[model samples]
Target: MTIPDTGLRTEPGSFRDPTNQVFHLGGDVLRGLDEQAARDYRTLAGTEFFRTLLAAGKVCGTEPVDPLPGVPWTTVLRHERIPFVSHPYEWSFGMLRDAALLHLEILRAALDHGFTLKDGSAYNVQWRGVEPVFIDVGSFEPVREGEPWAGYRQFCQTLLYPLLLQAHLGVDFQPWLRARVDGIEADQLRPLFRGVRRLLPGVPTHVHLHAAMQRRHATASTAAVRDQLRAAGYSRELALATVRGLTRLVERLDHPATESHWADYQRTCGYSAEDRAAKERFVEAALAAGPRPRLALDLGANDGRYARLAARLADQVVAVEQDPGVVDRLYRRLRADREGRVLPLVMDLADPSPGGGWRGVERASFTDRADADVVLALAVVHHLAIGRNVPLPEVVDCLVGLTRPGGRIVAEFVHPDDPMARRLSANKPVGLFPDYRTEVFERLLGARCRIVRRLDLPSGTRTLYLGIVGD
Candidate 1:
């Protein structure tokens, strides 16, 4: 058998599972499996249900590959590479909900085929733009005769609790998910559902009762408890019913309609038809001036107005915004349109995602993954510089770095006198942001990018700039 030229590099995020390890060789995503996992994979690959899901794009496509001659692995498989790997914390409410539902759907289908997922981790699911696809094929195992769902607690912690936190408590789950990588425990969530909220569907069983059981078995050996349950003949039917119950609960959950300043910014934005049209023309000219990009980054993409335009010039576009509601609304629209090239993520550029998980390399930082050929920083510089207290030079530097050499940057610099900028700088001491000047801004942009075009919008306070990065 032919060996890969480069040494196999294991995917950092996939180290938790001992049965299999993911590796990257050249452009191929390969996974090495132990004997038991290899057996399970062979069985799963032959199943009609697994094949159907793979064909339908609900699961990551996979096929067997030859094991390395010197490797200890019994089998090796290759999986389709996801263009971008995003985490649950970066997902909007709609995106997380869809992922949760997909997990349950896959689990139910697996159960019907006499197999079950060994664990439920939201991280196992990745996105193909607006759609979620399961990527952890090694998670599948043949159902044990009398075993309960092993992934039940993990499902509640990662998927169900996060949804309930948003839908039931009107709390944004992003911060919480980011704070705890493993996810919220039943005890942590149970407190929030107190009083009359205890009566909420699925709370009594999944949250309250689950927490109580955990406390009751606080000192009990896990193996002993699992063995006792198996001895008592925990039926697969019960696990299926539980999965169905959780699915129903998740289906009914929805993020509350909270007012977001930016979600409706397009309508409330003080822009005349002519001005908006002028802005669009300027952006279009910039995008058309360059080679079509493989990837584009639309910073602070409110309502996806410019992201959709970038999609026309780029093979793939990532629309990022700070407000989850805004991203969620945009995601729903894109999903409805079946947009497979534009991925919308909830991110605050001021505190962008960093390399995290084991030694901070398992999950890549935002900058690590973002190497855009076309960058749209329209109407966002002021927000990052003034609103978030980020320095002007830092803001310009970030934009320049995101745009690869020879790439293009479409950015808008809002004057400190602009109404929006004034609002963002409101109540601040005079000279608090001394560097917030139009001259300073241009100098910074010029230092890093070759100014291709500049247009002072009809609104005197706003200026649109198009620059090309030089090698």
Candidate 2:
């Protein structure tokens, strides 16, 4: 059935699946399903397994909605909005591992019930706080007898290899994921496993053999392979076994963060008891003075201390930290605590995530999604101004830009004489950053925000300013 066109904006990244299309109208996220997809959903949604997952919050909350007037769809469904849309590239190692396991668990359950996911794109998963939720309801389809799992290779590329990259090599996967959305090819990953690493569990089969098969069938017709597999008696039991094995391997994977220094900053940071308390009181006072924020940003959110505080006053908080190790540790804590309001991300503000995919609009840039009701830049200005060589004015401007007009900003300025600031600038030429002073920062900040209040920390080396963004 076709409905009159409405001004719904189609999600640029969702064009791959023609059977289902995602769109946004006002604040609602909508999906249009074709006849086949609608039929599949009707069956899938009725399953006990699906209901259990929904109850456990493993899948996106969905409900049938009145037909939306935009696309030609047999039915429509509305999805609960994710607090902040984060890409796999922005996820910590633990986040990716959790998402991978969630996918395999769903697939295993789906196969048990004579259903399977049609695609294994890691993008199919999103997060509500630390929990991973599968968002592509249309991916569920009746299991085709004799055909192999269609999503195996995609899963390996997008999820497994990236995890293995970090777990085995101690390399961060964020850059690789950001570089190619399709993920690392089996052939590309197979070469990385050398000597003793080649004997790692799940490596020889999932990587080496998978790459060999890719080369052998590079020019073969995919239809012909399905026919051959059918003749060889590829059964649902075999597919289920494969999914179970993958789930085990993913669960066994571990990424022990050993390289990032900032991961333990909270313990080593030279903040006396009085100084720490004073800083907390200042931030709490600032947030309490303003309207409770619907969304808040905690940049350089090491250990998520301030982010946890922000969560008390904000409906949702996006805790962004450049160190993957720090983020991974933070994610583990949140996951254990069942914290569902703060979303921890691994992102370097110096080189934040940018728009990519189809026409560079499928995935949005960091700045594009930075709109927040309040922003906390605590203990962050020095990292950008001195460590990254960002000028004072530009730093303040960027923070102010992230907040909506009349929104609040709680920012801390570290004086050049402070121990942390001195250490950050030690390697630089003498007097290289002459302008990184209290007066310069206050002046620049005042230009963009009306200073609400200012407090000098007990240490006498730091200052906190609460300001309202100007139009």
Candidate 3:
């Protein structure tokens, strides 16, 4: 079928499913559904169960739009665009766990209405703040009797195994998930659990047994497995029971506390109470004076002190911190307060998230995705310049690339004589970063942005500068 030209552009990562294809026309995010998907959606939409879930915010809300001529679809659906699009790999442990539970919850709810989820891909889920919402409305279909849940294996791989790797072992799953978009496989995680550890409550059935089954059926045809499951009398009852078991298992999983330098940054940092308070005030005033940013980014947002403040001013805030534990703690606080305004992500500034997948366009790089109206770089320059050996000009250019034209950047410059800077440069030779000074930084920043205001704290070490991106 030929796609209609409504000035709509197809999203790069949205072409996997043929039933529904997502497109963006102007500011509206629309989903064009095929005839079969339209029929299923109509059937599901009539049920009260779907309405209740929509009202409760468990499912993303959709509005029907007239199908475009020659599109070969019965209807189009307009979805509420999320403020920021974050992948499963960027999520913290608790974030992934909550997404797993949300998926199971939606699956169980659909099954109750004589419908079942066609697949259990973690990418189908996205976070609206700290809450997990199911975004794939076309994944639902009429349930088949005497058939095992088709998404069972996918659920284990995409959700269950990744959670197990983190909860059972202290291994962080972010890097693995990012490398393999489908998530960790059963066989991959099986070797990590040995002896008594394998006997853990849900590990055997979901991990060990599942891995064994995959190995035994390595060469078996898909139809052969279906026939076997059919002969064994797989029913909706069994599927529901499996969902219940997974719900309990995932809910019980938690991210164990790990040692991190940034997790205790506020306490260990040598900043006096007066100095810290002065920095906070400077950030607040800078935000107030600038245009109310619709989207703000906080680089090296350790513990989210400034991120929370940015949330008060901007419509959305993306807080990037390298330390996993710090991001986890920040995520917990956002969940507790139900703060959807700020999103906490774990990323190392020295090496930010790179672009890859499908000719390097499927997933965008960190710099590509971080186009914001305002950026806060509080107390992070020394780490990149002196600690990581990055030139000051490169750091300034990267920060400039993140801000939109006319956007504002509130950044702090740590003097070489400061304790933090001295500590970072202790082992390095003297001439490593000779140009790392406030004047040099201002000169570099002046190329792309106009300095609006500057504040020198009483500590006589750090200075805050507010600049607007050049036209």
Top model by lDDT, which number? 2
> What's the TM-score of every candidate structure?
0.95, 0.97, 0.96
Candidate 2: regions farther than 4 A off: 1-5
Q: List the residue pairs that clash in candidate 3.
A: none
lDDT tens digits by residue: candidate 2, 1-471? 122467687887888988998988889998989999999999998999999999998989999999854467899999999888899999999999999999999999999999999899899999888889999988899999988999998899899999999998888999998999788898888878978999998899999989988888888899988998899999899999899889889999998766567977987777889989999999988888878898899999999999999888888999999989889989999989888899999999888889988789888888888888899999999999999999888899899888999899999999989999999988999988989999999999998999989999989999999999987
The global C-alpha lDDT for each of the candidates, from Candidate 1 onward, is: 0.89, 0.90, 0.86
Give me the overall lDDT of model 3.
0.86
List candidate 3 segments past 4 Å from native: 1-4
Could you tell me the C-alpha RMSD of candidate 3 in Å? 1.8
Cα deviation of 435, candidate 2, in Å: 1.9
Please give, for residues 1-471, the per-residue lDDT of candidate 3 as tens digits: 224655777777777778988877888888888888999999999998899989998889888988766555678999988777787778888888888998999999988889999889887787776778899887889898877788888787778888888888878878887887667888788888889999986888988988898899899998898788889988889899999989999999987658788788888878887889899998998888867888899999988989999999889999998887788889999989888889888788898888757777677788888889999999898899998999988999888999999889998999999999998999999778889988998888888789988888888999898999987
Model 2 earns a TM-score of 0.97
Alpha-carbon shift of residue 399 in model 2 (angstroms): 0.7
Error of 1 at 428 (Å): 1.7
**Decreasing TM-score order of the candidates:** 2, 3, 1
